[model samples]
Target: MDRIISLFSSSALLLFILVVQNTSSVYGNAEGDALYALKKQLKDPNNVLQSWDPTLVNPCTWYHVTCNNYNSVTRVELGNAGLSGQLVSQLGQLSNLQYLEMYGNNITGIIPNAIGNLTNLVSLDLYLNRLHGRIPTALGNLQKLRYLRLNNNILTGTIPFSLTTITTLQVLDVSSNRLRGYVPRNGSFAFFTPRSFANNPNLEFPPDAPVAPAPAPLSS
Candidate 1:
């Protein structure tokens, strides 16, 4: 009777484990779709994006794409790949993204406001691209961002004071752009140097105050 009871308990435990495993859900290719959207828009001269297959249920297998243990995309290292074309808004869907390194490309167009949605971002390096337009105020939304470089682009606009709120920020380079107005020298901006704001001939400096101090972060 003891032996029979032990076998029944083992069976029940096994059944429960199976049920849990079967119910476990994947991120469901949402990441894949987002990546494919980028692939469709980018002009990959190096065939770098050739491995990006939309048919796969996940984007982890794609080259230059890094995923965490959870199989969620965490980094996209595509610097100096000779990629062209504008960035897609789908990139904002990568909630777990930590590094977005797309510098030294010929990419053009405005930095999408959707990029502000990447709350988990630690590095946002879009420098040395042919990108134009105003640096989005939405970029200040990255509370976790530490490295923010938008230099060597054709971007035009005042430095968004909202960036001052990023206490985690350690490096900032907005030089060599067509920027105007005054730079924000408050909050985290206190740590930056003249080089960070250099090359923007039209930008006013050593100014009175920022358009506004960094405000409280909004809910993601």
Candidate 2:
């Protein structure tokens, strides 16, 4: 009787472990799927993303991907890897993502509004790219964002006033873009300087600004 009872207890424990592992696997697969979608969109000449195998149960084991103790993706460090191509909206699925550093590449296309879904994001660096189109107001949703750099791109349209509401923002750089309209010098923007808006001739300061500089003449 003791032998039968011990076998039953062990079986139950094994079943419980399998169930827990399967649940975590499913969750990890969702993140992996999101990443694989991006992999399909990119032109990785250097095969930097070659290790992103879909058959893997967890993305944490993949290169350039990082995860927390719970196996949820937290960072994707693929900066300056000679990658060119566009970013897909599926990137927003990384719920635990904090740092998205994909700068100094030839990535072109509009910044996906879906990126605003990463409320936990702390840094978003897309500098030195060929991305164009209006900056999405949805970015205002990132309440925790600290560093927001969109410089050296061919982006057009006015800077979104919604960016002024992020109280936690520390480093704001929109320089060297084709942006237009007045710079927001209030709210969290009070900490920034004109250097942040340099090279954007169309971006001006309001006359009421304490040290209002004359708006530059637009270059033909």
Candidate 3:
């Protein structure tokens, strides 16, 4: 009886291990598919994304992609790769993503609101692109965001008030865009200066304090 009980216990342990492994594999495959969808929409003139193979079970081995120990994608650094075309909404599927550095590319089109789903995101660097359209209000969902640089783009429309909710935000550069309307002075925005919104011809600057006039009548 002792021998039979020991054998049953071992079998149960093995089955548990197999279930855990299978679960990890399923999650990793989902992340890979999301990234592959992005690669399909891009114009990779330099073949930098050649290593992205959908047949693979995980994208952790792909170039410019980083994954956590659990095989979940954590970062995607494809900055200045000369990649054009619009960003894919599937990128929001990377739940573990921390840094998304795709700046300095020729990418165009409206910023996808789906990106707001990256709750773990720390830095969102999509600056220096040809992207145009309103800043997505959904970005406010990223409570962990620190560096939000969308500067040097042709983006239009008012700055989303939702952004002010990110108290963790530190470096915000939306300069050189076509953005308009009131820049929120509450919360984290109160720390930012006019330079952060500089070169936007239509954007209303924070009202400067009135200057005192000289006593010209006393001199006369």
- The true-versus-predicted C-alpha distance at residue 50 of model 3, in Å, is 0.7
Tens-place lDDT digits, model 1, residues 39-156: 8889998999999998876889899999998778999999999999989999999999999999999999889999999999999999999999998889889999999999999999
Model 2 TM-score, all chains together: 0.88
Q: Give the per-residue lDDT of model 2 (tens digit) for 1-220.
A: 9999999999999999999999998989999999999999899999999999999997999999999999999999999989899998988999999999999999999999999999999999999999999999999999999999999999899988899999999999999999998988888998888888889878888888766467899999
Compose the digit string of candidate 3's lDDT tens values, residues 1-220: 9999999999999999999999988999999999999999999999999999999999999999999988899999999998999898999999999999999999998889999999999999999999999999999999999999999999999999899999999999999999998788888988887778989999985586222344577655
Task: Locate the minimum summed-lDDT window of 10 residues in model 2.
Answer: 205-214
Q: How many backbone clashes does candidate 1 have?
A: 0
Query: Cα deviation in Å at residue 205, candidate 3?
Result: 2.1
lDDT of 1 at 164: 97
| Alpha-carbon lDDT, every model | 0.90, 0.93, 0.93
Q: How many residue pairs clash in each candidate?
A: 0, 0, 0
Best by TM-score, which number? 3
What is candidate 2's CA lDDT for residue 25?
A: 89
